[model samples]
Target: MTRTPQCPGCGREDRLQAVPAVYLGGRDTVRVRVRNPDDHHDRTVDRPVTTALSEALAPVPEPPSRAIGCLGVLALLVAVGTFAAGAGAGHWLDDVPVVEGGGVFDENGIFHAPGQELPTAGPAWPDFAWLAVISALALTAAVLVLVLRIRSRRAFTRLTSGRAQAERLWSRAWYCHRCGTVHFRDAPGEDTRPLTFQEFRERVWQEGGYGDLAATQRALGGVLSIRPGQ
Candidate 1:
């Protein structure tokens, strides 16, 4: 039997126990300890606790994680396809202005419609039209993909580490070692730039509405290092 310490949180004696059951550490970290001031043998662990217990404590899940793979893949593919199409359209096709309506051209050089302007078949129409469509679709897809990848990576890190208040925000975000925030195996744009602690604290204070004055100041000092001069 391992001798446990009482929770400083609830002042219950004996390893993870409290005179009265209370939440502590992770979920199971604050286990159920029956306190019998009269008895020396009483204790219990109620639930099957795991690491996720601590992760749930984060203020927000943060970015990118809320998104993931397949969608990112599809967007990348579209961007490639659209860019190819745009290139083909812009460079290969010859613009032959035929007409500008949806009337049926009966194979002959004659147009058949009361007042509808005929859509003239241009030489480069096939190449240019397809290219343009592809390019537009592809670019949009690519942008979406890039954004999602960035976000998912960030989220995954947050999920794993449920970072503490004192930890350098920039340190965590840049070296998100757990989720591999910076390491890219020969992938494009793998170079990660981490914000300094000061920058991080400033950004958080200004952007995120964390209204804790002590926390805000601590973040600025710890993360940003606001030593009097530099």
Candidate 2:
């Protein structure tokens, strides 16, 4: 039979508990009085343990959402509509005759010769075509942004999965209540020095493939950084 590892601080193996079990056993319930005088019943609130031990053993936070929102889709749609409208307008305007000089039509529909006044309107096809090009560019940009956001979201999901696996590895750790430290049975080396809660958690993250994710997050400006309790 394999012998359990001894605690580094106390040189004993008796007062040990699994990290998950410790967290579960640390929970407490409290009664909260209602504010309204008419409501005499007190409400019971179940609160998780917030002690240093519990904090060290807490599960990894959920990944941040990076998917494009509804507003973004709406803007993309608007750009497409604008592009279509501009293209159609430009096509129709291309066939229209340009007004070169001021003229008037007689009551019998006969064209009158140019007067002293000059034509105020210029050809509109160029402006409409320019509008179409601008809207097309905007639509392209919106699509690129949406794709990037989706990729970012997928990366975050992978990171979250890695953290969860790390948490599972952490569950195998044993906390020594007597020495206020934690140790892993299968950890390498026989030095047996007790690790603080922070040290243990950090070790778990680093060794469980979570370090790579964290480095990537830092490189990407921390967009995948863990959020507060939510």
Candidate 3:
């Protein structure tokens, strides 16, 4: 059994494979490749050299789920619309009269006799208009609640999937052998400007954040060296 050492990059003890040497500028360098298929973490690091070739420790970034967010908003709006329409229909139906048993029932289903307190009341009957309105509103509200819950859950699932994919792709760090500078592929702190290896070296050592290339290399394990001049 060939025992591969723990990965220096992500620290996975298993499933580490030694990849073919990559010759850049005629320098043959060995790399160990390790990947977590579940999280989509795929990266290759130098065999044993230190000096932090890349910012591998930084957390992976997630992607924006604009479409999922929009769908959730749309579902909420539809639920509100359904509730409003049910209420409006009920209000309209409440003003109409009904005829039954050779007698006319008013909106409240009460028969009023004249010359008795101006409005007389007899044995009260059930009111069907308000009942119909209430029933419609209640049924519509229930269905709206169910639909909103389902759609919201679906949207959340999709958003989480998108974030996972983004993290996998952007989290791994990259090393520029020519410039000897290490930077994260998609880290938020990355610079947007186009810079050569020399420019990157100058910015890191002389500008700010991290200064003194020699000191940095010594501190990080002394795997890289600055060019002869600047």
User: For this target, which candidate reaches the highest lDDT against the unseen true structure?
Assistant: 2
- Which digits, one per residue and each the tens of the lDDT, describe model 1 over residues 1-230? 94443222233322222201211244454468775667877877565462332232222332344245566577667767766666665554444334446655656667666555444444444555765676567667667777767776865564435334323231223212122111112223322343333333443333333423224343221222222112
Alpha-carbon RMSD, candidate 1: 20.0
Return the TM-score for candidate 1, rounded to 2 decimals: 0.30
Residue-level lDDT tens digits of model 2 in 1-230: 97777776788778877888886675565555454456765655554334445545554532555345554576588788877788687663444444346777655666756643333356555767767776777777688878777777787676666666677667768877777777776645422467665566566666555664333333221112222121
Which prediction has the highest TM-score against the true structure? 2
Superposed on all Cα atoms, model 2 deviates from the true structure by an RMSD in Å of: 11.6
Q: Estimate the TM-score for candidate 2.
A: 0.43
Clashes of each: 23, 0, 0
Candidate 3 residue pairs in clash (backbone atoms < 3 Å): none
The Cα error of candidate 3 at residue 80, in Å, is 18
Give the CA lDDT, 0 to 100, for residue 32 in model 2.
59
Candidate 2: count of backbone clashes, pairs at least 3 residues apart or interchain: 0
Work out the TM-score per prediction.
0.30, 0.43, 0.23
In lDDT terms, how accurate is model 2? 0.61
**1-230 per-residue lDDT for model 3 (tens digits):** 94544433343434332111111222335798889678889888877342222322111111233565555556556655654655565443343333335454356867645322322243122332454455556556556666666776675455444344333433333433333333333445656333333343433333332333324333221134433111
Which residue pairs in candidate 2 have backbone atoms (N, alpha carbon, C) closer than 3 angstroms, thus clashing?
Answer: none
